[model samples]
Target: MMTDLVTSQPAMRRLRLSPTLSKYIARQYLSWFCSFFFAIVAIIYLATIVDLLDRLATKDVSLGITLNMAFLKLPYLSQEVMPFTILFAAMATFWRLTRSHELVVARAAGVSVWQFLLPVLASSVVLGALAVCALNPLSSVLLSRYERLEANYVRNQASMLAVSETGLWLRQADESGQSVIHAESIKPGSVALQQVMVFRYAEQDRFVDRIDAREAQLQSGRWLLFDAWLARPGVPSEFHEQLALPTDLTADNIQDSFAPPETISFWNLPGFISLMQAAGFSATPHRLQFHRLLALPMLFAAMVLLAATFSLRPQRRGRVGVVILAGMLTGFLLYFLSNFVFAIGLSGTIPVVLAAWAPAGVSLMLGVAMLLHLEDG
Candidate 1:
């Protein structure tokens, strides 16, 4: 009985992380993470700058503007690569610690794998929280600015569509001038507008005429208006059963004009989703993005678990190269799975909640199972 009590005391001590050990492990993990982050970000920035310069070679854009656009675009690309960064960082941290015999020392002291992993898991969760709360908003703002710059300097597209509590507004420009269109309601999946009004302006912003139409349909580079009444300056009003207005706009252009999900911040996503739904448009993409941000912390933790499975084995174990190759393959597979599921969500084939959460949830479970098999078996 006394021998058992003595053994249990040491085991209990091994189960808990001492303050010094926790800090040491956490610092090691964070150092690796920050190093990998900066390295990856630098690589992405350089590649993007090269691509942008190539694309803008024909345009009269200056180096300053190109650099500014690249800098603004960095945060969004960073967010996209963050998951892989975490995976690589955690793997490198564990592998280095094991190689240096630090984790071996802890194991020799009877510390379990889970006990030593606690610090890394906790740190990943904190990083994920910071990413979602602070980094995401900054990324969204910078990405939006980059898009605006690209539109103006690269694509030469004006802001074409906007939705509000009042209704939808559209503007199109041509050699003649510009026309502003308003519609009280739009069909959910088509370019059909009801209760439409069109205001035409000639060069120098001179008002030319106004047209009120019961319905407007965009077809083949023209707006086909039904039951339309046109009023011209210094002329009598005219009524027409059907009228065709020439436009360079098409269904594809109008659809592409909507703001993409990545342009919205995490804090603003819920409100944006609400506004989009209220405007009678499907909010699936925004809702999916919101839920994805919410699930990022769990995903980070899952990455830690997966890294541990591949890297925690002793150096004496053979097949190190095979194990690393397998780990990388697993990460790639998970990434493809995530993108596929997100595509499914965007298509509205599955619930937004399920599609957003499934990849992370599946990764967490797979990691846990792998760790259990490795550590316990």
Candidate 2:
């Protein structure tokens, strides 16, 4: 009877603490996360407003519009700092538990490290998924709208480029009034357009002529059109095997003119990448972005693991301030390293998948190594 009672008591105690501990840790982590997230959002919003006010002050942009732009940008900015938020949240949660001697008590009472860390880790995973699946789409939409509003009202400019399953449309102006070019597709890394149509305008925005070409390649100072058809207002259309269309536009300008990959939603990226690829445009940027977002959940979980590695130890074991500073420094290094590798990926120096995932992979391994050493070695 005594053995049964004793075992029953311990089992019941574990059953009680399991859920309670998870709830406590989850709540603590969430509190810190929200506090950190909102604080960062507020910081970004304020900074955005200041820049807007400075740039748009004399551009006929109203105070309301400026505030709206700032607010619209917050969602996208929030994503940029999410990993940091997770890191700070984990550190704060563990630090508080350690300072209050709660963690020490839990460890002494036979609570395994993973047992207490599970809630925070799970939270990190969920938050990362939500960031990709929910926040990302919302941010992408709002950012597009914001860019449109900024271009129309503040910049007084036309949309740079429009791409779809059908084709690509580009608009540019020079000493000659303007031109709208449509192409069924493009050849990657070169300004070579297939099934191209160019609508030309003369000075005073007069409809001057139209040229249709089976193919066109942009060279030093002019477009080399192949199998071209030239049509004019009153003159008969003429066909030629080759033609030179003078232009001020360059490969750099055309490449720079595409909408940044950041503006595309996660759900739309795969389709967009396909379209770009079929159109013979390099989709490296979009591919990199897609991989980066896909890796985000794992990266966030790694952040939590790394934080726990640095902050879970009792403060009495080391100088608390120094330990925290070291942890933060490590986080900073990770951030810069991620940026550096991502840039390399963008430049095609390495595979996009590797660039996007390397930081998270390294962080996860480092954390697991530290935990093994602490718990088992």
Candidate 3:
């Protein structure tokens, strides 16, 4: 009994130290991550604020409002740079530890590479999950508000499109008057609407007339209606087989008018997707965004693996710079590839799920393969 107790004491002490070590590593990683993240955000803000400042000079918006837009947009931009932050932070952490021979000491103490890396990977995954589940909703709401302010104050525009259970609604304004257009359904990729109603309002906001049509086709600078009914408050409605209404809107403008995927919170996306589909608009972008958010944590975890694969080993004096640069370039390539595939998916050349998951899947696999080659080969 005395011998058994003596042997187990070392193992028990090691077990207790393991959690302490994990916490320490996670704290270091998170600190470095926040440092890199804010650094990048600051750089982006400086780059963008110049143009915003110029635009604001020509508008009535105050400097405070412009700064608010910049701050409001920061969260959404943070989500984009998070994976890079993880990669850089992990690489820096492991490189520092390895350079200082801490990892060598740990290995001599029987701690394997896998054991230390486990905590870093877990931390990255947790960060990714928090970004998607918590940060995303907050960013979306603020981004939507920023866009509204930009439209109202900076660009002098109003709401362009809306979706409801009954149908799709659109609004347009010109020097003559404003028009509200409604359609029971819309045909994606084309500027055509079915079962259309148009309400015309004069310069003083007086109701001028209403037009109903079985179908309307948006063409260059005009809308062509088939079987139209024109009605005025004091006159009997007149029916026409064909009528053309002047418009400043084009097909591209109409298609670009929907609430962009970034503005809708993750919690609200599924309902928005259903509503958009029901209203006969392509909900592909929203679906793609939701799937991407679903896959984000795994993506960030994969970044940890890749970072470790590059920096976990001992750093050689002459080769260290090259290795870090190569790792950064690799991350850049992965980002570009993900974007290319996403664009393809948006164009309907591939499935949305494939586009959304491919970046993380490929990163995870590549990282695993490299780690295997280094550790086991």
Candidate 4:
């Protein structure tokens, strides 16, 4: 009777102390979480710098430009790498706890596994929010700078504003009229024409004239067309005549005619879409990208949940290696599935918003289910 009473007293003491122990575990987990997070970021940054140096070695870009480009590229890479970093950090934290037998002790103290996971989940939520609100804007700025630097220094080929398998197309306008130009191929600053056609329309919505050029070169705010044929669209079809054409339109002017979708930022996406549509350009892809950005926070949170689900199991089962592998595989599968959905969305097979958010939603559900099963079972 005396021994049984002594054993019961210790059990009562542990039950009373469980909350304090759980809180202590939470603090330790957060400390490890932060340390691992920053370490991973540093390692990724160093690897990126090394790779950038190798690529820039053959180029004549200035050091300042190279450094600027590298900084700009970091935000984009951070977004890509951060989710996985969260996973690895969680794995490391849990593994360390398991190795030290702290987890076992906590479990034995009547502290449920879910009690210990609260801190990790909180940290994940905080990180996901930071990535979306703070890091996203920075990424937008850097990406823009990186693109500009690439266009200025690394791109040797005459930049193409638009291309199709059918042919190249551009919109050019001047004081006289607006023109739609189509050609087989454009060589940098020059328009190379196997078949070239230009439609000239008047401001009054009248048919003005058409020009067919064999070849054209943009020079000094003007276009010089050789072996050109002129026709008045409003006049007789038989009135076509061969001639040389000259117009005030240069490569810079042509470049200004069409804008790339990536140049727009998340904040400006709605306004930009309205502006693009008003200016008569399709804004489908830009709209899609905008929705995807909005979904990113949820995606990041889901990534954390997925990682925790795969790696938070008991270590005594001797399946640590399998758990790590499963975490990696889950991350990869989620990535590919998100991309596939995005592609389908872009192709108009699915709603853009649905495509963007569905993967994150699905993963989150799966993670929650796994957590409930493991914790309760």
- Identify the candidate with maximal TM-score: 1
Q: Check candidate 4 and list the clashing pairs.
A: 158-188
Per candidate, the number of residue pairs that clash is 0, 0, 0, 1
Q: Give candidate 2 regions above 4 Å deviation.
A: 1-17, 150-157, 202-206
Please say which candidate is ahead in lDDT: 3 or 4. 3
TM-score of each: 0.93, 0.91, 0.90, 0.65
Index of the highest-lDDT prediction: 1
lDDT of 3 by residue, 72-109 (tens): 88888888898999999999999988898888887776
lDDT of 1 at 133: 97
How high a TM-score does candidate 2 get? 0.91
Better of 1 and 4 by lDDT: 1
lDDT digits (tens) for residues 1-377 of candidate 4: 99999989877766553556656755765676678667766776778667777777899867776767777777777777776776677777777777788878877887666667766766677777777667776787778777767776676423334545556576655677677777776553234344678788879756687778777655565556667777784665432334444465555545453445454567777876675554334556778878777776666667666766766666556688888888888888888888899889877888878887788789878877887887888
Candidate 3 matches the true fold with a TM-score of 0.90
CA RMSD per model (angstroms): 2.1, 2.8, 2.9, 10.1
Ranking by TM-score: 1, 2, 3, 4
